[model samples]
Target: MIRLGGGPLERIVAVGAHCDDLAIGAGGTLLTACRARPGLRVDALVLSGGGGEREQEERAALAAFCPDAELRLTVLKLPDGRVPAYWEEAKTAVEELRGRTEPDLVLAPRTEDAHQDHRCLARLMPSAFRDHLLLGYEIVKWDGDLGRPTAYQPLSPGIAEEKVRLLQEHYPSQRHRPWYDREAFLGLARIRGIECHARYAEAFHVTKLTLNLGD
Candidate 1:
């Protein structure tokens, strides 16, 4: 298990292929991190969805979720479902972000995810943030491809509800999806919570982890 002492986190970067992916995957963890550090700066870097009305929706959604955070939200112009084709460009973008901010932690999508874009991003994350602590979050889709997750970040029931509420409120385009509902949110949380022995929690898969067992 990775344990952190009582000091605050100065910077955090959340990377995702789409606008709502970060929120859906790691929204609770983000909320918990922000609450732990009042002045913490959290950046949401979306590889796409920066054009047209999607940009506006993402901006509003981030503002609501991270009111106090110094937001550095960017939606790359790269085409959706084609991130793997632009592998070099995506690496450059992530490297540029790494150059700008040396975050204490980096949150990214898990490598085992069924989505091609998510898996691509997960594959690229280690190259960009080699020295930083990486947390890989999950998103439930129709494929039912959720795998064994080793990390758990517990969330309050209220925060869990707020996550779903915010996702629904921010992305009007996603409301039509049949899987996007309260049960999906709570059911996933409930399952993860059971793993962590908490009321609610989010699970993550870490490809590599170092334990400082010394006291």
Candidate 2:
């Protein structure tokens, strides 16, 4: 495998359609990033589930997931599973985030996601963040929409365990869900790790990226 790494690695913008989306999809990557750089700045935006317990869970969950980073999160009040209806609000939120931070990276939902809200958010991301690197994170759910990701973030055994622990501990509401179990979470990570030759890993679909190779 050809190892490559270069980017500001300082600021990041993480967007999701719902409360636990970010954690379930890219929590390991976020853990890896923040652990390497203690004070990384993360600006998180979600299109739905604000002004409620779900929003509360998001705030606490992200804080735990981000670790030492300076995290700022926005949970919009747009109804869940109906993001298309509030198209303007979703677009405006991403644009506003773009205007505020020149993020070195944007962690967002993949366009191929089976969920309508996720698809809408993915479609809106590129329009707002025209000249930035964006990694489309995947969420394992009943939709069975997982695809072959183009990129991988390898995680250590310890990091992988921590991610699962934090996810389970932080999101109390999600515990009742059938798929939200240790086996399901770790199983996917283990599979991704096999693909990347690591003990555990997270996969992503990078739609656009600028490479800087040097001598």
Candidate 3:
């Protein structure tokens, strides 16, 4: 595999339509990056589940996922599964985030996600974050909406296991769901790892990226 390097990885922005979306989609990548660069700045925005149990779980989960990093999170009170109805609020929130930081990378849901909430947020990202590197992360569900990813973040055996452990430990509210098991999480990671020739990995869809190929 040909490895490519980018500019300094000091800051990143992670946006999700729901409370647990970021953790489920890009937890391992967050873990790997934060560990390597202590005090990395991570700004996270979750569109729904604020001031409730889900928000509580998300705060704790992200704190654990992003160890030793400067993490700032905002959880809105938008109704779940109704993001499109509150389109203006979502767009304003994303624009506000854009005004706050110039992130080296942005992790968000895939534009083609089966879930309406995810798709709505994905579509709004580009409007605010023009000229930024936007990576669309995936979440596996019964809808079977997984698609080919253009980028991969390889995780070590320990980091991969740690990601699972953190998810299981912090998000007890999600445990009742049928798909929230160790095997399911690890199974997806394992498959993505195979694609990138790693023991474990998290995949991402890139709609646009500007390569710095030695000018």
Candidate 4:
């Protein structure tokens, strides 16, 4: 398998349609990235679950995921599962974020995600950040929307384990949900890791990327 590396990333913006979406989809990658680049600037945005306990949960969760990095997170008050209804609001928020930071990477929900909110926010990405690398992250769901991700971020054994631990530790409210368990999280990572020839990994779908061969 060929390897593609993103060299010396300074800033990353992670957007999600709902609370826990970023952690579920790209938590391991964030952990790995933060460890690799101390003081890496991370700007996170969530479209829903704001002004509630979920928002507090997300803020703490991201801090754990992106340990020691310059993390700035914004949780919007848009209603959950109704992102498309608030298209203008979501678009404006995304565009405003883009205006503030020109990031090297963006971790977001894939356009083909089964959830309407996820897809709604995903569609807004390309229009907002035209020149950046946005790796569309995946969240395995009851809808069976997990598709073949075009990109992979291989995770180490320790990092993969920590991702699961942090998830279980931070989101107490999600614990009652049947799918929110260690096996489910590990099971998906194990599968994605197989695809990338690693013990564990986080997978992503990327619609566009500019490969630079010249230094």
Candidate 5:
């Protein structure tokens, strides 16, 4: 297998359609990266759930997930499950974030996601950050929308456990869901780990990647 390395990840942008999306999809990756690179810059944007309890949940969750990074998050008030209707507002938010930082990596939803809000943001991302390494993170749902991902971020057993722990700790609002349990998170990680020959991992769909074989 050929490995592609993205050098010196000083900054990253993580966008989500709603609260808990980032934590569910990319929390382990965020924990692993932030631990390895202390003081990393993490800029996050959530299209909905602002000015409410969910926003509070997201802020606390991301802070814990990013660890020592300089984390800045924006949660908007757009109605949940209705992001496409607010296209102009969502587009402006993404564009403004683009104007602020040229991130080395971007963590976002996959265009093929079953959720409309997630798909909307995923489609909007490429328009703003055309040349960046954008990793489309996945959220398991009742729709059975999991796909074969092209990229893997291997997480240690400890990191995987920590990710689950943090998810449980930070997002109290999500606990009532039947699917929001330890088994669901760890089981997915275990499967992805088996695929990548690791103890655990987070998988991502890469729409495009540029390989540089030269030093």
Candidate 6:
């Protein structure tokens, strides 16, 4: 198990390929962090949907979720479902974001995710935030790509239910999808919770981590 140094984490960056990925994946962890450390600065970056109603919805949702933290939401203009084609551009965007904000913690998608966009973004995250703590989040899809996760953050049942409710309320566009129901959210969290011996939980994969086994 990877251990972290005990200290205050002030700056946090959550990067995702889509709008709701961060909230669905690591929202509880983010909320726990912010609540534990007041005045924490949390920035979210989405590589696409910079314009139109999607951007507006995301902004409102983030504001509601992270009211106490500073939010810097950047939705790039890159076309959706085509991020892999524009690998260089995606990398450049992530690098630029990294240059702007040096966060203490960075949450992103797991490379083993099913979606190509999520996987591509996961591969690009390491290039920018090499020194910070990185948590790779999982997204459930038809591919069933969820693998064995080494790290888990338990979420309260209320928070897990709230996450699904908020996603449904905020992102109306994605509601029509077959997998966008509360059952899917709770099912995934329940499975992860079983892995971690919690009521509800979110799982992640870590590439490199330092352990501090001190008293």
Best by lDDT: 5
Once superposed on the true structure, which residue ranges of model 6 sit more than 4 Å away at CA? 1-6
lDDT of each: 0.85, 0.91, 0.94, 0.94, 0.96, 0.84
What is the per-residue lDDT of model 1 for residues 72-174, given as tens digits with 9 covering 90 to 100?
Answer: 8888877889999988988888888888898888899998889999999999999889878898999999888899998898889988988888888998988
Q: lDDT per residue, candidate 6, 166-213, as tens digits?
A: 878888888889998899989999999898889989888989877656
Candidate 4, superposed: residue stretches over 4 Å from native: none
Winner on TM-score between 1 and 6 is 1
Worst 10 residues of 4 by lDDT: 1-10
Worst 10 residues of 6 by lDDT: 1-10
* Model 6 / residue 198 / CA error / Å: 1.0
Judge candidate 5 at residue 45 and give its lDDT. 96
Prediction-by-prediction clash tally: 0, 0, 0, 0, 0, 0
Give the per-residue lDDT of model 5 (tens digit) for 1-215: 44678999999999999999999999999999999999999999999999999999999999999999999999999999999999999999999999999899999999999999999999999999999999999999999999999999999999999999999999999999999999999999999999998989999999998878777
State every prediction's TM-score relative to the real structure: 0.94, 0.97, 0.98, 0.98, 0.98, 0.93
Across residues 82-107, which tens digit of lDDT does each residue of candidate 4 receive? 89999999999999999989998999
lDDT of 2 by residue, 12-102 (tens): 9999999999999999999899989999999999988899999998998899888899999999999988999999999999899888898
- In model 1, pairs of residues that clash are none
What C-alpha root-mean-square deviation, in Å, does candidate 5 show against the real structure? Answer: 0.8
- Candidates 4 and 6 compared: the better one by lDDT is 4
Off by over 4 Å in 2: none
**What local lDDT does model 6 show for residue 135?**
90
Once fitted onto the true fold, the runs of candidate 5 whose alpha carbons sit more than 4 angstroms away are none
